[model samples]
Target: MADTLRHYGPAAVAWVLLAYRVSKGRRGAPDPARDTVWLVLLGLSLSLTLLTPAVYAFTGRVSGVPNLARLLGHGSMLVVAWSARTFLWHLNHPITEVQPRTRLHLGFLAATFAAMSVLFVLADTPVDDARFAARYAGDPWVLEYWLVYIAYLTPAFASMAVLGWAYAHMSTAPLLRVGLRLVAIGAFLAIGYNLHKALVFASERFGFSYPPAGHLLIDGVLPMLAHLLVLIGATLPAWGRLVNAPESLAWLSRYRTYQALRPLWRALYAASPHIALTPASPALVELVTVRDLNLRLYRRVIEIRDGRLALMPYLDLDTATAARARAAQAGLSGQALDAAAEAAALHAALHAKALGATAVFGPASHTPGGGDLDSDTVFLRDVARAFHRLERQSHHG
Candidate 1:
């Protein structure tokens, strides 16, 4: 289970995040912060992919260099760390502040990669072992190579944790804040992994034994979890913006409310065809073909109001009073009671209008109480729902 999770989990998360980022990039204007995040995900994906057992073995065999996959994988991790730091820097500073530091960051990254590569070349390990660190433990240049990698990564991970945590608290956007905090926690875990590896290397060098299981935890499990967290964190803010925009939510709400209003509107339109400004479409056709929901909803509300006014001559006070009493007996109060009574009154009025009953009206009863279009829409939605429930109960009873 540990091996499976270690090899596949981070790779899956990183690739998904990278793909998401790429898709978003096609629609958006170039943003340094977003681009840096993309690079971070890309590097993480490559590192995890290269470190997989099959890919590692294939690369080693094809390259005619034992354990060359290790160097490539480590190089990719270096890219991840560097890009993550750049991403954070871009978030915290303007382009003017970030540009000068970019050169210095790249120079350090280049130097570290060069040093690691030189050490890797000097190390005399002809055998390609997936467990390269354990196999070459305490071997002269191998120890130095591992130490160099750790030395470069330790500070990078520490800084990332610090920056991520601090910026998270400073951020106002909820998703971005949460994402930064996750990144911080991931960086902290990565630091622990690095320290554990350093200790393992030191223990092996000093003629002490460390459990083989320790390597599995530090290398596979810890890094896998850390990378997953970081990948999710880096992508979440963008994902949240794409999905949870206020306009999107409002449009969805309006669409649902429009659909819900259909039963009431259909009955009203049937009783008074002139109440409709536009001839009604079949319900399924309307659902599939309708656009400009805001305008359509506005027109529907107006039409329903006109229908109610036209039926007012048939509205009976006795029917509404009876409904109010029955609804009260059913333990409904406040807006719910009002809505139920209103629904009953409208149902009775429609029947009266259909039967050609004599006009018997004073002031219109069951006038929906709302101060604005949105409030009226909400009240009418409740009425529509209550209307359906009353119809179902009558049918079932």
Candidate 2:
């Protein structure tokens, strides 16, 4: 397991770094919480990477991993576990505009995770001490036995149930829905394996030993495989939408929620006629102030990161058409993309109409395929986030 995870440690590290870059650089969300997660994950990655070799050299087995390796691994696991617990707690006990019942459900998840974390620690105590065994009983003062079971098992089962319901109600994007289902199935398999292992362990303590076939489980296999599935599935939404998609699916590709709620802001303005009274025409909509947009609203914001992916808006109509040809040839071939763009133009037009404005324009109108993907300018995303805040406030207030 240690040797096998060598590449994975680096991969995990890369994921954390890449996620941070994407979040801060692309998404422009300078959240310290996100940074902390990144740093901690990175720390784990390094610790794992370094310790794998050290423990391998010291003991040939992880049963007595070196103190440095043990400390690093334990520290990493503790932080990661704590983070998971906190996340669940926050999820269950939302302090914001969350519903009471929903909050209660989240709180249950939090409590469940806390219980699991305790067991996980206790079960794992003296982990590097080969003498330490699940034998006799897990230490008393700390939660032992089934508490860990409750902690680990419940969330897995709960997630499965929740995702099952979501899959039932969800529509269209089969890949994404299927991805979610697979994830749930994977969870079920992992939990089932752990439960079986716990049973085996319990039976051993009680002197009713059965041949431990823990390896017969998907538990050991699922971590790697499930990780792969999550990688493929989670990216399905992004990859299918904007990352590398045909124009037809591109609109459906990214920030669907932002797109849906954006019109409501315009609606708010129309519903209150007095808000537009200062305008030459009460029907005219001004979606944003001039300061909100860069001086070049009509100019494309194109940038490329990591060399291959284009991440900028196209500068001109001709460039957009050219981009479509290039994109289609590169396997992004699609019906919607053939028309290339007019969606952005149409969106601007609709938003204008919604705001009772005669004209509205977006830089996307002048480009092709909603601006070339050759560069990564998340400016459009920034604008969406800006408006998303307003939309949230308007809805909540």
lDDT of 2 by residue, 1-397 (tens): 6645643544464365446445644345553323333443443454444345444245524445323343344334334333322322332344353345334645654565565555554443443442222333434423244544436445634554365336524635555555456545544554555465555455655557653665443434544453344334333433454444444443343334223323432333343333332332221233232232332222222211110011122223454456557657767544344433323322333344555564323254423233443122333433334334444565698
Runs in model 2 deviating more than 4 A are 6-102, 109-124, 127-146, 161-165, 211-219, 240-397
Local error of candidate 1 at 195, Å? 1.4
At residue 169, candidate 1 shows an lDDT of 83
- lDDT for position 375 in model 1: 86
| Runs off by more than 4 Å, candidate 1 | 26-28, 209-215, 241-397
For each predicted model, how many residue pairs clash, with residues at least 3 apart or on different chains? 0, 19
lDDT of 1 by residue, 1-397 (tens): 8677777777877887788777766555778987888788888899889888888899999999999999999999998888888888988899899988877878888999999999999998899888777788777787788788877788888888999999988987767777888898999999888777777767778878774665675676787778888987888887867667445645767898999988889989999999998899999987886578889999988988898898888887888889999999999998888888889988998888888888876874447657899888988998889888877786898
Cα lDDT of all candidates, in order?
Answer: 0.84, 0.41
